[model samples]
Target: MTREELIKNIKSKQSFLCVGLDSDIKKLPAHLLSEPNSIFAFNKAIIDATAPYAVAYKPNMAFYESLGAQGWTALEETVSYIQNNYPDQFIIADAKRGDIGNTSTLYARSFFEHLGVDAITVAPYMGQDSVSPFLGYDSKWVVLLSLTSNKGSHDFQLTEDKNGKRLFENVIETSQQWASDKEMMYVVGATQGKMFADIRKIAP
Candidate 1:
């Protein structure tokens, strides 16, 4: 979806809610275990239940991928289901991928082309080339990992630069040069609270 379409969704729905389909097979309801394509079945239920309030669906790649080939097929089917049924809702693959040039390109193609998510969460630790491949797709987005909600986020993201700018701030500033706000978004955790104020200073 384009930036305008996403904005339109937010306005019409009056919500910016994003549903995360972190469906772990082990935690699924007992009855669902007996179903064929259990992963997709669980995701479809969640989507149907939450679609009214959510503007986007983000499927955590690791959870689905851990189950192997069948898991991957389920992920594809889940994405296609949303695409066909909710064309205006944005889809994000929470892959958090970052590697060298070639590896990144393949990842970009896998998520943005074949699997067909409108966006992918990416790790920027590998720098420009690692993240740029995702930016080349039209109307696609790169949700760069910045200040996370994890306990250890204070370790690196908080490091102060010579000019006293936080590492994540520098990341936000420099990366903004790579793409417009519509194509790029930083992952700012709600637990960060006031820190989001700081993020807006750079990202706004």
Candidate 2:
């Protein structure tokens, strides 16, 4: 979806909540395990239960990848369920993937052409060439990991470079050169709440 469309949807729904679908078999309600397609069933239930309160659903890839082929099947089913049922809701594959140029193209195709998510979270540490491939798609987004939520985010992201710019700031600045504000977004963590205002200044 376009940026305006996403903004419009958020306004219409009066919510900006992105429900994280970190579904785990062990954590699922015990009753669901007995059913066929238990993972999809649980996801369906969760989506149905929470859809009213959220404008988007982010299915973290690790949860599905851990299940091997069955997990992938379940992930596909879950995505299909959303597309078929809740078409207006934005779907994000919270797959923090980034690699060399050729591989990144395949990664983009995997999420955009094949699975067709609205956005994917990606690491920016690999630099521009690795990131630009994902930004080439239409009506999709590349959410670059900037100042993250974890305690270790300071290890690199907060450190100053020779130019006196922090790594996260440099990420936000450099990634902008690759894509417009509409198609690009930095993953400024909620923990770094004050920094978002600063990011907006640079981003705007």
Candidate 3:
């Protein structure tokens, strides 16, 4: 979706909430396990339950990947369900993929073409070349990982460079060169609330 569309949705919903659907098979409601499409069944119910309050739904890739082909099928069905039922809600594949040029292009095609998610989380540690492949799609988003909400984020993301800029500042600055704000967004952790001022300086 375009930046204006996303902003409009956020305003209309009065929410910026992106519900993370990192559903685990072991944690699913007791009865769903017997169904052939249990994962999708559970996801559809969760989506229905939370649809009123959420403007976006994020499915972490690992949970699905672990189940191999079955997990992938469920994920695909989940995306299709959201698109058909709640077309306005943004869908994100929290894959966190990062690779070299050619491989990154294939990865982008897989997510954008095959699975049809609205956005995908990418890693900027591979630099601009690894990220540009995903920006080739219109209205699709590349959410580059910047400051994370983990303890280890301080280890590198906060490390000062020779220019005195932190690593994440450089990630934000460099990745913007590959894509405009319309197709790009930085993942800032809620824990990094104070650093939002710094992030805005680069993004705004």
Measured by TM-score, the strongest candidate is 1
Instruction: Give stretches of model 1 more than 4 Å off.
Output: none
lDDT of 3 at 197: 93
Q: Can you tell me which runs of candidate 3 are displaced by over 4 Å?
A: none
Tens digit of lDDT per residue, candidate 3, span 1-204? 778887898999899989998989999988999989889999999999988778999999999999999999999999999999998899989999989789999999999999889899998897888888889798999999999999999989999998899999999988878888889888999998999998999998
Q: Measured by TM-score, how close is model 1 to the native structure? A: 0.98
Candidate 2 per-residue C-alpha lDDT over 1-204 given as tens digits, one digit per residue, 9 for 90 to 100: 889988988999899999999999889998999988788999999899988878899999999999999999999999999999988889999999989778999999999999999899999898988788898789999988898999999899899988888888888888888889888887878899988777887887
Please report, as a residue range, the 10-residue window in candidate 2 with the lowest summed lDDT.
195-204
TM per candidate: 0.98, 0.97, 0.97
Ranking under TM-score, best-scoring first? 1, 3, 2
Winner of 1 and 2 under lDDT? 1
Better candidate by lDDT, 2 or 3: 3
- In candidate 2 the C-alpha lDDT for residue 1 amounts to 86
lDDT of each: 0.91, 0.90, 0.91
Clashes of each: 0, 0, 0
lDDT for model 2, please. Answer: 0.90
